[model samples]
Target: MDIEEVRKVASLARLSLSEEELATYGEQLTRILGYVKVLDEVDIEGVDPMPHAVDLQNVFREDAETESLPREDALSNACKTDGQYFQVPQILDQKD
Candidate 1:
């Protein structure tokens, strides 16, 4: 990339770069773009496009029916409860 292009990019990103930093980044970006250009020239006639570098598989446990905890037992550790349900402080103001 050129110095002007680097400056424009830095401005877009809200980065305040010095003259030396701008020059350095310009050279680095130019080299990175050069590498990308080289990659574009590589032959891939029969290669299939892949989402990931390695193969992936789902490994999950099978779901099973289970008994649930009793309501009273579940509310036992709660700081505030209305006997049947847990009570919490109001978060929003009441509107008319």
Candidate 2:
């Protein structure tokens, strides 16, 4: 990529770069793109796409009814709360 293209991208990413940094980044990005171009030329006719390198499986147990924690005990861990409910900071910008 060119220095101007790098400067545009850096501006979009909210980065503050000097002229030297822009030139350095331009060269680095060009090298990275060249490496990716080489990867694109590789043959993978029968290769399966993988999300993870290792095999993974979810192990589940038999589900049974269980007792839940009491309301008073559950509310004990809150930073701030009313008598019956958790009181969190208001997030909206309304007058009410």
Candidate 3:
């Protein structure tokens, strides 16, 4: 990538980069693109496309229900509360 290409990308991303930063990012993007070009030359005639790099099976544990906390105990540490629920400041303005 050239400085102009980097500048264009920075503008599109709404970035305010200095001249030195533009030059630095241009060189970095060029190197990264070079790596991608090298990957294009790799031979993968029979390789299958996979979602993950490694094989994964059912990795989750079985869900089981347990006893729930009492309502009073759950609301004990609240900063402010109504009789049955937590009270928080209203964020939206009421319009007529």
Candidate 4:
């Protein structure tokens, strides 16, 4: 890709790149696209897309609450609290 095209992409992505960084990314992206182009040459008549390379299953346990702190104990760490609730600046309430 040309430097101008690369700059345009950087603008769209909200990126600020110095001249060196821009040149580096431009070269790297061009090389990646060239490799992707080569993959199109491969013929896979009966190949199927796989979720994993090896047989695997979920090993996670079911979600269950083991223990929970009391409301007063949980609120003890807050800088400001009104009994049980935390005292935070209400952004939405001030919008009107």
Candidate 5:
């Protein structure tokens, strides 16, 4: 990548780098891409794909159904209500 292209990417990522730093990163990114190209030529016909760097297992407990609180008790704490539902002020601005 060129220094101008690196500068544009830095601007998008909210980074502030000097012109010398941009020139340095431009060369470094090109070298990294070259290494990736070399890795692309490796053979791995029988390799098993691994999703994670380390193995993991689920540790959650079993779920159980339970009774819930009554609606009257749940709505008892509301400041304003319309018999069965809570009421609140208008959220949006005035409209025509």
Candidate 6:
């Protein structure tokens, strides 16, 4: 592609570029497109597209409920706490 086309692409991608950056990207994109054009000429008679290079299988275990730590131990480091639970500022408080 030409430098003008590269500038347009940079605009569409929401990228800011100086004149030097535009020139650099223009050359890079041109070379990349040239390489892709060369690849387009290759023959692939028996090739198979891959989801992944290796075979894969699903492997998951059943979920199970588990108990959490005792409330006293869990809340031991709290800045402040009521008898049974940690105290935090209310989310809906206007001061927040």
Best by lDDT: 1
Backbone collisions counted per model: 0, 0, 0, 0, 0, 0
lDDT of the structure predicted as candidate 3: 0.89
Stretch of 10 with least lDDT, candidate 3: 87-96
lDDT of 6 by residue, 1-96 (tens): 788998899999999999999999999988888878877777877988678988779878778778988898888988999968878878785674
Write model 1 residue lDDT over 38-57, tens digit each, in one string.
77777888998888888778
TM-score of each: 0.43, 0.44, 0.43, 0.43, 0.44, 0.43
Instruction: Name every residue pair that clashes in candidate 3.
Output: none
Better of 3 and 5 by TM-score: 5
The digit string of per-residue lDDT tens for model 4 on 1-93 reads: 888989999999999999998999999999998888987888877998787998678789979988799899999999999987999888785
**TM-score of model number 2:** 0.44
**lDDT of every predicted structure (CA atoms):** 0.91, 0.90, 0.89, 0.90, 0.86, 0.87
TM for candidate 1 is: 0.43
lDDT digits (tens) for residues 6-62 of candidate 5: 999999989999988899998999899888897767787898888888877877876
Give model 5's TM-score versus the native structure: 0.44
Candidate 1: where are CA atoms >4 Å away? 42-96
Task: Report RMSD for candidate 3.
Answer: 8.5
Candidate 3 ranges with C-alpha deviation above 4 Å: 42-96
Error of 5 at 5 (Å): 2.7
- Return whichever of 4 and 5 wins on lDDT: 4
**Model 6: runs farther than 4 Å from truth?**
43-96
Q: State in Å the error of residue 3, model 2.
A: 1.1
Give the Cα error of residue 64 in candidate 6, in Å. Answer: 18
